[model samples]
Target: MRSRRAPLLIAAVVAALLTPAAAAAAAPAPAAQAVVASCSAAAWSGSAVYVGGNQVTHGGAAWRAKWWTQGETPGTTGPWGVWERTGTCDGGEPPIDPPGTEDFPVSQAQFNQFFPHRNSFYTYSGLVDALSAYPGFANSGSETIQKREAAAFLANVSHETGGLVHVVEQNTANYPHYCDTSQPYGCPAGHDQYYGKGPIQLSWNYNYKAAGDALGIDLLNNPRLVQTDSAIAWKTGLWYWNTQNGPGTMTAHAAIVNDRGFGETIRSINGSIECNGGNPAQVQSRIDTYLRFTSALGVDPGGNLRC
Candidate 1:
């Protein structure tokens, strides 16, 4: 039996988009390579067909096409897949945006533009404060790459929260069901405390525990902090964005920095649910939002916009 993909996103994100990684065992884990390649190399494209010996960069690594192929994602593609692991390439380090806002790549005005109707709970200051936790959030690669990533992230955030209008999940009926009594730690904060909350709507006791542990916040017993503190809420969102592999082999951060395109970000967030014809409407919605955000930021949306 296949293991369920780590539902590493907000309640709304998981429920609506993410699903199991039924083929997790198929690919071997990709390791970072020592022979660094040029950061300026063109990244692999899902839409373009490749023949033997063609090369591209993806997920911080260099890859060479073993034979003719198309649409096979790197890193996650198995050893038998058309592409072979070459070596690690320079993905880039944190670079400040043109906005000159300390560390966050998105300017306050840009964020406000993206979510003008956003709840007061989703403060710009709160998000900026959370940037320290993951310097790589939108800080990797070229300025255009950085802004594109920022747009991709916020686009999904907008979709999950309904343009940042809803801070919590609309369905309170699913609240108590997120707890897993089998977890040795159980639900110290009561069975219903782990309901969806914050910008992306976190839920489930295990997820709260995992996010809390990573951020050094005791959320297992005080899951409501995600609902009360805007900074902490944004931290959870960043933690998932930077660290969790979600339904894919790489994190969303890796997807953008490595030039795997925005569609890989969608796959990382939602498994195959909204991709591969599972839900074209949802995929189109995300792409539309991403395009809007990228346009607002004055950057090209790049290739492979769909999953």
Candidate 2:
């Protein structure tokens, strides 16, 4: 009886282990979770085979295949299997045009023709960087809107710089008057270094500080950077154009995108000096440049061309 019992006990233990193994076999292995492959920089080619979840770039945009394919392009959807648009290779939508292409609008030759006697250094290339930094430069509105805004901005800049002739303010006598002793920073770049510089002739220590702060430069301490670096100089101009409303009205950016008219921009930039019977000749100069630019762009000059 004891021997029989011992055999039974041993058999019971073996049966327990065998039951678990049988249950495990019957349960079906846990299904493996499907994996989505990470996007890669591999370029798409019509000749190369691609599997589902593969990513590639074509025509400056990224795409992912939904299934296997060889001849189908990445950005198109058809019988070869659908390829979804992922994003740009740089992880965002590509600009409407390359940086230097549509940003400045007018070509170097057009700008040269506009201002033939202009200083060789005050170039379209010199302006691209500054214009790019200003969000209002090209992406402000439609192509027509953009062209008009650009024309408006360049018109003011033309007036300021004498059709891109002067980099620094021409009237040296007014230099020292720009510094404001009332400000707490107190003109770290000295009393006179903040004289108008760049396309809009950025003037005053406080203005220099503000523009430098926005642009991540230290114009307060090194105001001469506006005079020395063409890019920096133009940035100051764009800073003024995009940010400040001056002593008269709305931001030049707001003036154009809102369709408040070019004359409002004149009122915004220098209405204190040029608008409301202040200086008709100066206002006319800006309007003339704007009309010329619009004509070059082959667009209607619109109304309210004067302040």
lDDT tens string, model 1, 156-270?
8888899888888899899889999999999998998899888767888999999999999999999999988999999999888888888777888888888888998888888
Per-candidate TM-score against the hidden true structure? 0.66, 0.66
Worst 10 residues of 2 by lDDT: 89-98
Q: In candidate 2, how many Å is residue 197 off?
A: 0.8
Give the CA lDDT, 0 to 100, for residue 147 in model 1: 92
The clash count of every prediction, one per candidate, is 0, 0
After TM-score superposition, what is the CA distance of residue 219 in candidate 2 from its true location, in Å?
Answer: 0.4
Displacement of the residue 286 alpha carbon in candidate 2, Å: 1.1
Q: Across residues 130-193, which tens digit of lDDT does each residue of candidate 2 receive? A: 6768866746677778888878888888888887878888888898899999999998767878
Best by lDDT, which number?
1
